[model samples]
Target: MSALLAASRASLRASKAPVMALRRSVHIENTVDNVLPFKAGKHNKGKVAVGVTAFFVTGLSLPLVAGLWQLYVPIAHARSK
Candidate 1:
């Protein structure tokens, strides 16, 4: 058991050097030009708006729901004597 433990420990220590050597800093530019690069921004913008609207409507998270629910949900009668 000690021999197996020693071998595993030695293997783990040996593996660390290559992993450290492979580690390096990475830089990614975050810009609309770099990310989207759309030839027609106006059409693409409208498409994105439609997609986002569909997503929210499908998820039932539209902002007007809370206010509309008050108008739509049936009001309960008073139970107090």
Candidate 2:
């Protein structure tokens, strides 16, 4: 999951540069429509941010629940020795 997020960040960064460059070259008259694609890029950023947070929180919580169970359950004990 971490690798996936890293790859996504890298991809976004790599693609953003050229789009920004394109923005600078376009005529000012239709600028709003010309830059419309970039607005979708911003939405992609939001989606990626949410995805990373969801994956991270779920990843951290699963092992924690197991660890707590091991600590509190008597019959599940291996640490008693």
TM-score of each: 0.37, 0.38
User: Which stretch of 10 consecutive residues in model 1 shows the poorest summed lDDT?
Assistant: 72-81
- Candidate 2 stretches with Cα past 4 Å from truth are 1-40, 75-81
Model 2: residue 43 alpha-carbon error in angstroms: 1.8
Clashing pairs in model 1, backbone N/Cα/C closer than 3 A: none
Error of 2 at 54 (Å): 0.8
- Tens digits of per-residue lDDT, candidate 1, 1-81, equal 999999999999888767667776855465654454333255577777887789878678655777677765555323331
Steric collisions counted per model = 0, 0
Error of 2 at 5 (Å): 49
Best by lDDT: 2
Off by over 4 Å in 1: 3-11, 14-29, 34-43, 61-81
